[model samples]
Target chain A: MAVTTLEPTTGTVPTRRGPDSPRRRKVRRQAWLFMGLAHVLTLKQYLVGAFFAVLELLFLISLPQIVTNLANLVTLGEPALDVPVKERPNSLFMLVDGVITIALILLFVAVYYVSVRSALTQERAWPPDEPTPPRRRLRDTITGAAFPVLGLAPTVVLLIFFVVVPLVFSTLVAFTNYSAPDHIPPAKTIDWVGLDTFVYMFGGSATWTAALARVFTWTIVWALAATVTCYFGGMLIAVLLTENRFRVTPLLRAIFILPYAIPSVVSLLYWQNALNGAFGTVNRTLLALGLIDSPIPWLSDAWLAKFTVVTINLWAGFPYFMLLIIGTMTSISKDVLEAAEVDGASKVSRFRHIVLPLVMYQTAPLMILSFAHNLNNFGAIFFLTGGDPAVADTTTTGAGGTDIMVSWIYKLTITLLKYNQASVLAVMIFVVLAPFAIFQFQRTKSYREGEL
Target chain B: MSDVVVRRINTAAVAIIFTVVAIAVLWPVVHLVSAAFTPGRSMANMPVIPFSNGFTTEHFEYLFTQTDYLRWFGNTLIVATATCLGTLLFASLGAYVFSRFRFTFKRPLLMGMLILQVFPSFVGMVAIYVLLYRIGGLDTLWGLVLFYIAGNMPFMIWLVKSYVDGIPRSLDEAARIDGASNLRTYAQIIVPVARPILTFLAVTSFTAPWMDFILPKLILRSPERQTLALGLFSFVTDKNNFFTTFAAGGLLVAVPFVIFFIATQKSLIASLAGGAVKE
Candidate 1:
């Protein structure tokens, strides 16, 4: 990270005389006069420039008074309107006063511009023939500083406005009692109730705690079940598809990707319908084949609901895993696989000993990410069941039997209009998921660098 | 001879396993599309002989006539296209700078982008809602696109920048020596070379705004502004004839991406894996 500086071709100093000399002073004065004229010309180039310039000047002059008035309104909770009519300024009157003040400020700016131009003309400092000083270097560096800042400004502003600010606000809401009727108008103010929501959410009733525990347990179960199932499922598919001797490998790969190619919402919705409790094709076919006496409530019962969501997730996610694993499998050097073959290693042994480990090592971060994704999986659970099979007698608002943290957050925000509570849940979810995200990010960064 | 024959048998057996697994993966989807035109209210009510009930386009027709399917499709296309274009422009410029420049605070800037990616998209849901409400973007397509880009920019920058980094620096130097300005160099030399990864990014980024339900549902409160994903949700939740039409709509949504994947599967697979490794 050493800074590389290029050498200047000539001595930094020009042959011009000192600024105190008559020649230098004349050049400096002329430069000032030219700059003043340039400023006037620039203003003339745009029709509204003069107007805006005056407006800008007025804004600058009256900014302090404006700030004071704003502070008064904010701190005093709106101006008292019941004061004596003769003594009191009404809010409308105050607004008018502000406008007049701004107008006077604009007039002042018009006058100041004339004076500043005359001053700059009298004391100009320019002309490149003069030797540049260390101060010029400092000026150059200061101006150059804006380059990187300008380059990064959009990203930084976006992050602050969209990411950082939201995160802080959400975290703040988590400490307050911000839910339900308390969230309604005027009475709807988000009251600061420190840890009350968390305590109520995690404690209070056994049912509340039990419901949370169930969701958390299922969240972990879904993440694990989905990740592991997809991982092995993908690995197996990749291995089969990539085998050199396998004819029609392209056709098989295409078939394998059908699930991945389809949008998750479409597939998930279709599957939800297909797995309907009574007349779903699966149930109908199963019963017709005499597999079971009763149609299983695939989405109504809690366990069945959880199982179905995972199964749907598996279908939706495994193709992605297969695609990724196949890609990683191809990148595995041929020599190593050939070496395994030369050693007379059986196909299973070669896969178990060589291929699986290599692919896992390469794809470990993605697997971690997939796990985190499943934990916060709102789409599958949402489109499929909308977190249905409502938990019995649960006091929580919209806590479905199958809701993950995300769907629950959705329930709070969109369904119940409990922004404060939703914000809290969102922050809590971030806190839980942040570490895994960090790990994935770091691993990916290093992996990228390694590839480079 | 004996060993070779055994290995051949094993390979055939492996291929057979794959064929079966492929069928298993495809069966549900195939059944779904078939059931979409099953010509009955429920599966139980349908004739046992699949197409014997007579093939029908009723589900698709129902989707068009009953729901706001066309509106949803148009909204999704507009948002997805705008998002793709916006993402490509901003992410490419940002990634180019990150990849090429040696500047102060570069590490911190890169790190910030990475960290931003990790914050769940939903965390910003409240803040964005308020911000958009203030700015009058509520229930608007533009509001959805803005949030979509904001949610997606970090990952796209990281992905695209890494791909750009893999291109030889000499190519840039060569162009510069030929009197190409920085902008020209990027536009002429770098972008063309990086087309594969750019396609990957465009498709994936476009797919996000297209497939996303949560953001559109939260932002687009008006039924007319609903994207396909949100529009489909209406039918899925209808609890009646909507389910069959929902399947048809789902098929409609899936068709384009599936066709795209099939057409560009090779490049898509290559770039996806390349991006993962680069990541």
Candidate 2:
């Protein structure tokens, strides 16, 4: 070990040294490098050293197991006829365990780094003017940096083992052949098929390419239409209500909020039941009213099903923006609107020039966020259409006429057991949504001034 | 001015349009509520107008007696309550630490969580299912509760952290001076003062599981372990024609939920719009 010594004490005259003294400067420099042995290791140093050693020992002991898991993750468990059934290695288990092991190892490495850096920080601040006791130093460290570590430990652990591990495992599934009937574990093993799913999805086969193009374009269209329709439709109601002209405004407001107040699953399912083509209430009612030649195939025809989903979505969706816009509009000062009105501006002009701009300025971010929300609105499509009115190609491609990427992902995973394809779609979704996430992140309040 | 004439036309037009839209909006709601009390099991036979089909309680009776509706409701309540409590506890601890402590990678970690929150939780369906199977979380309410708590952490933690940051550090310092430990100060001072925001967090988190169907449907395999969403959905599937019963079960959940939502909507709306406006 590298050693350093302090200057010898003067016999008569005391040394006139500032903070740049050799001993002080050397200690600071060595602390940062996490090097050099002083004359004695304080109790705090011993504790910190012991902590690092324990982590190191744990990592070393687990290193072999980790390697085996990672190897299994790649190979996905080879076939062993000689092995008993109970001892058979399963590919899916290996995959999940491998992911968990990798996550744990990453956590271990991170903690190891943090402990070392913390040790250095403590060492740099060592030996206070009063020569703090080692026990006091350790306690000070605990109350300082270690406080956050202890406080957040449980949350971090839960997030990792539950959230992060599963996400990583699924993302990894995108690159492998982990589908049903062929590569399922215990019966057979999975092998990595990098870029094959991507190629197959994008342009490898005509049917898949057609499905991808159709679903992607529809998803974009649906998101845009849903956002625009809901935003403007809600704005209309909010603007009208803000007129405050009616004595029954409160009652109407209550009536309007019923859609928003009810749980979405219940609403969607109820609408699905109500709109059933043959015996549903809507069709029967229309027939009774003499409003149709015959029963309308509301959810049966592909084009009509798409329209029905969007219109119904408009019904379920508009209330949120109504509440939101009303809140924003109420906050606007009365002066701006009055000023526009006094200038001989018509009601239309006043709305176009003043109220619209203010509301948009305030709620544009939310609109963008809502657009992102609509892209993956699984229940809106799932509960209503159930991606019904399957097109000719739906058998070959998992997508239905009304299926958004998210709902299609659901169908792929649950009904079809097409895990690999589902993961690929999930990755595509991540790629598509990443930009929106970054934009939203930048606009978040805490992000702007998180320094505090 | 000619503008006056136009304004009158516009107001009349707005009134007519509002009336039409209002009728359209109330139509389905009335139909749903009336369907719950309608005499028939078939949805096609039920009249469109409210109470036109004649009121009956057979559906509600069937829901309570013949089906596992109560068990499903209980499971939902247990799972939702556990998720809410767990999210509150962990999120508060995380928020407190983040707000008060100066640690490395805090900013990046927060940013990462913000990004991750955008990805829908169902994207990891396969892995979560397999992971649950390994841990025996399948068909268990606690497994569903565990997933929800973990999923809720990132967003709820950020929300509460922002709220906690507004709280003056002086409160913590004063508690410290009074010989209170850090955890004690957090529990005593920070939490009580942060109650309003915590209430907002509680409402959002609690309401999520009630609306969700896919997660519960995936994790819960047993008839006894089904949630309200799963149970109610089962009533009107392709295989079954229990539309009236489904409506009845749905109404039970909606009535109380709507009341609760309307009551807390003021704070909920503020909390929601607060994020956008903060920019």
Candidate 3:
């Protein structure tokens, strides 16, 4: 790891010297001078560095002037303009500040340049006679290995700025009195207020509490109902399509996947119209068959609205589940099922014992992810009902009986402009889902281990 | 001989059950199309008879005449096309680098991308809105496209990277031996090999902007810039023209995508399934 030297004017000489040698002192002096000039050449490299240095200098020289101006502006108002603009800070003082700022900036630039160039120069100066050391090779390997990190810098920076910073800012907002039409920054003059929003949500304020409870209940019910109904319904379709006796299995499979391929919004709007009580196709067909006397209030009544939304979600979601299950089912070894069949297992028994367990085991992780997705299902509920059957209460903002936590948060931010509360809700959602995320991470690790 | 007969019976029963289920599954879509064309007492009073008393192209006419339906369609096409092109370019390049290069922080970077999918993008809504507003992207199609790309990048990068990873490194090595640089190797070798996944990505990416409503609603303030999904919302909400015209518009939106999906279904399914298994 010794530094290599270029040919010297005196001779082909090694620059390695004892610590107290005069040659060492002369070499260090030359290195410092080279570093200083290199720093001057790379001014742009230290622009950000220079900016801070200048800011510090300005603060020191201009603090008194700024305070005096602020006092005049506050006290004299219009009269302050009649006074002559104060003389610029003393010239000698300004010069000193500027020089000091420049010096610091130049120093920073010099240090950065010398370090980089020396590293590069030393790397190039390795003697032709000696082999590169193992330790050096290992260091190079480690450094080169960080290429992916360099590649991911933009995405990581974006995630921090857009996702992490906003999340943290919103979480902080939740603990403050930041509310509609007057969201002030929490500066030194302002005091922090904590947990008032949460208290209001859960306290004896009947409107908020009732809306909270209702939305929470519906969110859980919707998630479970949508996930389970889709799971079973999809499994059934998958089983039917894959059955050896089915003549038109491929066509059936294609048709089943149609709902999934169409985007969820399209499906929701299409179904919303199809389910309209007054002129919808479903009611017409039902009445044509004499199934009911009057059209059902599918989107107007609370329970019916919730049920319709869930059913639409199930319709939209199941096809993907069906696809996943079918894939899983096909991957099962045919010989295992053939063996069971030869043993005289009934069709139901074979499905229950052989098909179901295998598919379930393989698709368990996907099913869990689906559950999380359903819990945060926003598009279906928003486009279909817009969380309709609006609760009669006004104080609860714009949330309806069908609102999930996500939709409720939307209502808070967009419709009501209760951003502080929305932030609180967003944080709460993250908190609620954190455990599942951790579980998923752990599962991925173990899965990797198992594969190894 | 008796067991053979029983097996035949079971087969017949399974076929019958499948047929019944298929009918149930398909009935609604058939009803939707038929209702779209049915002319008599709206959809609510249609008879079981196959032929209606009258048939008309009146709904389609109304959709074009009375609403900004065509304009919305055009807007959506532009947005979806731009989004697809942008996403494919950036995501493919990023995915290629990650797949081909031995770089530091690769593992952490991949994990970070995966973790992003767990949190919905709406969590950053306020910040994005303010940032876009300050930067003058608010109320513009470009703003919508930016959000769309950002929202979809994590999944797209993972997908493209997985497909790229499946391609043999020897291809790159061969190209390099032929004196092609890294960029040339990617363009001349890797991309051509990854065409199937690229097509899948394109279709999915294009379809996303066409289907999206929330982001456009948030960002695009002017009616002139409203996309098809938002435009369809107007038709659905308008009490007078909600029924027939809404059906017509829905049919219009669904048909193109249905055809596209049918054409590319095999490749799409293969790419997705392959990615999942490899991941």
Candidate with top lDDT is 2
lDDT of 3 by residue, A1-452 (tens): 01122212212434443453442343345435544222223222233224334644565576676555444322222212333435322221222233233434444453344334443333234443445411233233223322233334444444544454445555655665455554422211112357878887786467777877778778878888998989888887778777773556767677777787666666787677677788776777778889999999898788889988877777787777777777777667889999999999988899999988887777777677777888888888888888887668634577886888888888877777676678777877777777666655555532365411
Which pairs of residues clash in candidate 3, taking residues 3 or more apart in a chain or in different chains?
A145-B104, A146-B104, A147-B103, A147-B104, A148-B103, A148-B104, A149-B104
lDDT for position B89 in model 2: 94
| Reference-based lDDT, residue B216, model 2 | 93
Badly placed stretches (over 4 Å) of model 3 are A1-169, A181-192, A204-206, A333-354, A392-395, A439-452, B1-20, B38-53, B102-108, B238-241
Rank candidates by lDDT, best first: 2, 1, 3
Model 1, which residues run further than 4 Å from truth?
A1-151, A204-207, A339-349, A393-395, A444-452, B1-20, B41-49, B103-105, B177-179, B238-240
DockQ, candidate no. 1: 0.39
lDDT by residue (B107-130, candidate 2, tens digit) is 667776788788777778888888
Global lDDT for candidate 3?
A: 0.64
Model 1: which docking level applies?
A: acceptable
What TM-score would chain B of candidate 1 score versus the native chain B? 0.88
Please give the ranking of all candidate structures by TM-score, highest first, separated by commas: 2, 1, 3
Fnat for each predicted structure, in order: 0.37, 0.57, 0.20
Better structure of 1 and 3 per DockQ? 1
- Give the per-residue lDDT of model 1 (tens digit) for B1-279: 698998889887886787677666776777767767867655455443345566788988887887789999999999999989878877886777677765444576677677768777775565556556655888999988877777777888888887887888888878767866556766898789888778777887888877788888778888788899877777656565566677678787888888988887777676657756766
TM-score of every prediction relative to native: 0.79, 0.91, 0.76
Q: What's the lDDT for residue A366 in model 2?
A: 86
